[model samples]
Target: MKRRKAIRNIVLFSLGTGIIYSCKDKYEAIKQLHLKHLIIDTKQLDILDDLSRLIVPLQNIPELADHTALPFIMNMVEHVFEEKDRQAFMKGYQSWDQEILSIKGRAFSAMKIEEKQQLLSEVNEESLKASQELYTVFNTVKEKSIQYLTTSEYYQRKVNYYQMAPGKFKGDVLLVDLKNKNDE
Candidate 1:
């Protein structure tokens, strides 16, 4: 009995170690893929930030840039977007930059605000008419930006929409007798 128990413990330990190493290997592989594919450069990040600000301009807020939305959008793009969607976004982004350069003979980052707006409008119209994938990318960025901004604590606080916990529970509200015709 002791020998059988010792053998069972050894087998369990070996299996557990094997499973742990396998999980570790998978984690490393995922990390490598993220590093190679999902990582964005500073310039690209700046471009995304500028594009987001253009898409969702803050009117009453004092902040010049989107503090919450941009980061959230970036995080979603990195972690939540599927492989095909990520590829589509990358392709669309590159094409957008090329279109801007071809049209204005300058980098998008260097363009004036009016020029940027005009370019964006033109591209938006073209994307809507020409390609569903391009349109999806554009709409995704805009929608995600709006979603993150609206859901942010800062925006909620600014709008005075934040409610305390256990919010507004009515325990003993009187119910009207809708079934009785005379009660009305």
Candidate 2:
């Protein structure tokens, strides 16, 4: 009887352990994404996510909570980017936080928003001595962020609101002013 109970307990424990391990494995697999040409691990994706959040700044505004540039940027990087851009992106992505660590003595996860912003600004201003790849990554990310933001539904509707009106609303002295300006 005691042997039977011991065996049962062992079986239950083994099953539980297997279940837990399987779940953990599945979660880990889901965490890191495998792109066709580029592999963006969870950590790298998080950094990009944080950067996107920094650029668009959706946290402050309630309406923009649903809008994000990260996904769009990722898709573009996966599909639209050329081989050279992809190589530069990978090199930059790898060295990006490392440069931050060298300069700030901390990783992106440890820094505040302002600190991150300052670091990126340094990259833009050519203040930080980063590699060409780093600069490429910076430029690409910035350009894509703006592109995504401008093309986003929220930007189209609220931020970039334009009224549809029919035609030429020139000033009173339009033709004369144009002729005089050209003459000058």
Candidate 3:
């Protein structure tokens, strides 16, 4: 009887241990970034993702679940930007959020859209002039995100329609106001 009880206890203990060990850690480190030139890590990418969502042109959308321009911006930084610029941008980004936190008393991820916009409005060159890092990070993300939004397929299709040809037709033009010296 005692042996049976001991066996049962051991089994239950092993099962509990297995369950606890198998469960995923809530604070698991994010996956590492795989950029050729830029050296951003997972945490920085997450921060950049948040920043990208804020700086993008589409403020009307409620949930930008996966519409971040991170890939495009990262690609631009990796390919188009020179080594010096990339380094400067990254150097600024590493601690840029602290400036906003100081003013808003909340993390960028925690702030609402309006709060973010207000904080960003205050991050101009004059405000961040004391720290080039803060300015660099804010400016880089803002400029690149806007560029991505304006040139994106959705923006082109929905917001800014492309014009294949420059001329337009007017159906109700009056001949009396014609500026032509000779009627053609």
Candidate 4:
């Protein structure tokens, strides 16, 4: 009887582990397929990745690139954004490249780290001060990018929320009276 129970427990544990592994594999496959179908331009995608890295750089913990946040951002832009907003975002994205070229006389990716930082700072300032459609679009994309990154599964898992234990509810539990305890 003891041997039979041991065998049953081992088999159940093995089966549970296999199921968990298979589910993880399936999820990754589905995510890859979704990314493949995304319609964003490749260069634009690279720019987004660079910007995301700048916005949320790696420190003691893993960065946006480690969690594949760029693809997630692209997926959001493709599916979550309204048509008009998507067009505006695309226009703003293109203007970012053009603006960089006009200011630095080279591609943004080719600039030095200090130069990139200065340029991004200028862009942020301009976005706040200017009321042009381009600036509005830039601000929209920046806000969305930050929002998506902070709320993403990877970020959540790496940060505090994942570590918190859920509290249990007990409807019939007697409430402790502090005054009674003091009297006792």
Which candidate comes out best when scored by TM-score?
A: 2
TM-score of each: 0.58, 0.64, 0.57, 0.55
**Cα-lDDT of candidate 2:** 0.68
Top lDDT hit: 2
Which of the two candidates, 1 or 2, achieves a greater TM-score against the reference? 2
- In candidate 4, where is summed lDDT lowest over 10 consecutive residues? 18-27
* Pairs with backbone N, CA or C atoms under 3 Å apart (clashes), candidate 3: none
Per-residue lDDT of 80 in model 4: 80
List, residue by residue over 1-184, the lDDT tens digit for candidate 1. Answer: 9999997897686545321123333233323333334444445555666777787875345652444355566557667889888777766664655555665788787888898787678766674243455555577778898888777667665453455673676676555532242233
Ranked by lDDT from best down, the candidates are: 2, 3, 1, 4
| Off by more than 4 A, model 4 | 1-39, 58-60, 63-65, 127-141, 153-159, 162-165, 168-184
Q: Which pairs clash in the backbone of model 4?
A: none
Model 4 alpha-carbon miss at residue 162, Å: 4.9
lDDT of each: 0.61, 0.68, 0.63, 0.57
Candidate 4 to truth, TM: 0.55
For model 2, the stretches where C-alpha displacement exceeds 4 angstroms are 1-34, 162-184
- Single out the weakest 10-residue window by summed lDDT for candidate 2: 18-27
What's the lDDT for candidate 3? 0.63
